[model samples]
Target: MEGALERSLRVFSGRGVLRTEYWDATIERFHLVSVPPDTAYQIGYTGTEPLWIGAWSSVGGDEITDESTLEPAARPEGNAEFDRIMATRSDRDLATSPGYDGEYDADPDEDRPEPVVTSFANTAAKLCPKAPEVGCNADRLAWIAELPELEWFSDSTVMKLDPGMYASTHTHFENEGPHEEIYWVMAGKARLITEYRDARLRRFDCAFFPTGNPHGIGNVGTETLWIGAWGARGGIEGDFDIANLDVADRPGQIEEYERVMAARKQRGLPLPPNADILDP
Candidate 1:
């Protein structure tokens, strides 16, 4: 009987038949196979069929050879050379304080004449409508990123507004966005009149406004007024049509608006009618 059973098993095994069981932990499936090497076979359960096959390597293991791989520890000198080249090509070298180049510095000084002026009109000419008088203008040494040679961020223009012995009124509108505007009274005193208040901003003093806020500046002091304005959002359009506001015709209205603003300030409430005073 034993000899007969051994012969029977040998006959079945010789016909490319051997039984082995495998548990796939990932899929939670058990597989039983009787197949030759490199041969595919299908197994089914509950009307679902899945193929099973034998591979030379285990599944989900690294297929790449170690000999063909790049080892960071083995290429110290090559990495150093690459680092040196990257540092040479970087803009870090230009990121420093103002340096002297005959007349201008990389950075600007309040006491000195502006090193550079970037015009917004010139920049806007490439984009949309133009505003020559009250567009973007700044007198500062800047690093224009677009034109690396020019040394500012954008193609915006800069203007030098001077209150020479008398106060002058100018309308301004921004197209790009709100800017961190500052009125650095370099030589004389000035008053900045926005949609809100008529505050006295003196020389060397600075004031800031959120983007899209419409405002204007006038030299209220008896001297040459120099102010510096620069911001990433300075290229925005003005929210209100400043040209339409007839300051001469609305003097009485402005006085009443000012009185209301004073009361709002005293009560610590939100800015009242002054907030939307320029909507019309």
Candidate 2:
């Protein structure tokens, strides 16, 4: 599994042309310099740009592999000293500050809820019932996994499609800019169709679609298909190619119409408005 996971990571990371312009610009902009050996270095990030650090070491002109030569490194003790200083400052500030009125019962730090646990089975599934008008071919299902709000992620979902079912090729955007997507095949086989290339997806296999790349999936095996997907910044605004998709079983045109209308209403559009469309 570890080997396969590494291979998948490589496959996704190397999908597109690598760019070093931003990296070069950042190095110049920050006046960055390499740290000298045996020297302590630190950086306080302001979240203005992406930053990553890597370390490497070699012993006797080769990589270290002998466990017998390993020794326990000293852990940083600055945290304890910093905490002590902060505690002393806090105490001095409180002594000279105004007394609290006790209007709030709970401490601000303690007000956060405990970690939430949920499963794919327990999460509500987004249904895609067959609708000819919408160019849907079959009934499909998707579930948004319950997770704490993330800083960079907008979606964490599991989608299912039955044999012979396919979804329309689509691209997702947020705030008028293309957002990235990643999908891992959890069960069954799939044919990932994208504008740039198509690939077969097996259980445990993963793929990533970078900005402006349109993609979709088709269940090409005998069993049901399940895919775990994650998207950056949510990617809710979509541009779909409905003609290429193949949908299957499920009915009720009225229900489909109602669902469409409700979606439009949620977007704060007029009740009897033209179909929502995206510019190419």
Candidate 3:
């Protein structure tokens, strides 16, 4: 018989969750640089219900191996440190924090439940600068994982892609994958192409790629692209191509790809372009 995690991944393999609202999302933006375009990082959680949803994989400095299927990294010993940093925050504050918006508890008069807080600061700190930009591209990026808070459902992180960069095409179906991928576009533009579907994405859009599927995202415009992504296990998987990716990837990446395309067509804009054929 299959184990619990395996059972769950099998159940959620084909699902895709896209952001439906903008103003209602709980998102916090940050940066490591002290200059303009400090828009280098963002973290948010929008859970896809029913499934024990969560994330990992695709873009990171390190290649996540199948071992991730064993389970999330052991919780590091920085809960106290993270608690101290967040101690000033109350349940009310958590209710209003990024990732909790539009998700208020049923009874406002009832005492709000405290959010489960997990810290990956230990791991994050370990990936810090080895010397001012000498051997450290990872440090420039913001990352959060070991989110015990999400019940090992997923690990979340952000990727900052510059214009013209073509993300390596890969499937995160190995263990930590089998994850239904989710992308929240915080800034800029890109073309997301799967073997069957392709779409042009822009600011505030979002995208969903099923586990085990092959896809490529390339920044096709002139600005930096900040994508907030997550992976959760559960849902239907298939080969049908989803058209009209602009609305979804930028903020409205949605289930109705055709509807989104119609509006774009009415506006005289071209259909989403093909994925970049960059030299590997």
Candidate 4:
């Protein structure tokens, strides 16, 4: 049984399309599928308890143009901050954790750079200097300064808010397109209020704000909360360094707001009072 189980997860190197098989012990059969190049697949259960699989590919034509066959371009080496973060990481922390494994391309044509890594223990929290006047009542721990290879996203920060605190009411704007952003609750509850919608989010909950959407969030629960925010890069090149937000785009609310004050307002639209979190 152990040998069969080990073989079930084994991977081999090959070119062109790849095939994978899932062994369903309940029915004693294998579900086989082919994965095209430059495509990805995942298997999981739906909310209704039905098994499902999904496949996705990049937009445009079926084939993606390969990188130049000539010498690969020089990639950006680690900066001072990147070096410092790497220095603080211990070997044990970099090692693969138990109960997790993945297959990798053994050899590739293009030059691949080493991944930059860090932990919260190696970083410190600082007062968010961007929009104190806008009532963004939270401390920010930035991650983008040390990760330059992250080309698409401009800002990545883990924000911490105490109970009864409210974030800024502003829209992140980009000259070329609407600034897309995602907020994922890491440790607490959040009430995300935007121009068109207001949602209460719990741990593991995520919300996406499309371009031109003005939004603000608050710590609605009694305990301290933490949320991870990532926004698409746009506008002037140097603007990315700052939290390029149009604070005046919307009216500001109180510095701190209780859940009861927010509940009094209508639920469909953005809340006037700041507020959410999970327990149990």
lDDT of 3: 0.39
Tens digits of lDDT, candidate 4, 1-280: 0010000110111112121121111110112122222211122222333332211112111233243112222223213222322222222243221323333223211222222223334445545543545546555333322224333344445667777677676555554234566777766777777654567888767777766556677788878777766555432243333443334332222222233234434454434433432221
Encode model 3's per-residue lDDT on 214-276: one tens digit a residue. 555667777877666655543322222111111123221232334434544676544442223
| Residue-by-residue lDDT tens digits, candidate 1, 1-280 | 0010000000100112121121111111111121221221112222233322111111112244342244533543434333332333232332111222223222321221111212222232111122212321222121111222121112221223433221122322243322333334434566565544566666446665554454555554545455444333322333432223332222233444455446546766344212222211
The whole-model C-alpha lDDT of candidate 4 against the native structure comes to 0.41
Q: Using TM-score, rank the candidates from best to worst.
A: 4, 2, 3, 1
Q: What overall lDDT goes with each candidate model?
A: 0.30, 0.43, 0.39, 0.41
Best by TM-score: 4
The TM-score values for the models, in the order shown, are: 0.29, 0.43, 0.40, 0.48
List the candidate 2 regions with Cα displacement exceeding 4 Å: 1-116, 131-136, 146-148, 174-178, 234-280
Candidate 1: worst-modelled 10 consecutive residues by lDDT: 4-13
Write down the lDDT that model 1 would get. 0.30
Instruction: Report the C-alpha lDDT of model 2 over 27-132, residue by residue, as the tens digit.
Output: 2111212221221222233344434322112121234344423331222433332333333334334221123332333222222212122333456767766554
Off by over 4 Å in 4: 1-111, 129-146, 175-178, 234-240, 243-271, 274-280
**Order by lDDT, highest first:** 2, 4, 3, 1
How many angstroms is residue 75 displaced in model 4 relative to the true structure, after the best TM-score fit? 26
Judged by lDDT against the true structure, how good is candidate 2? Answer: 0.43
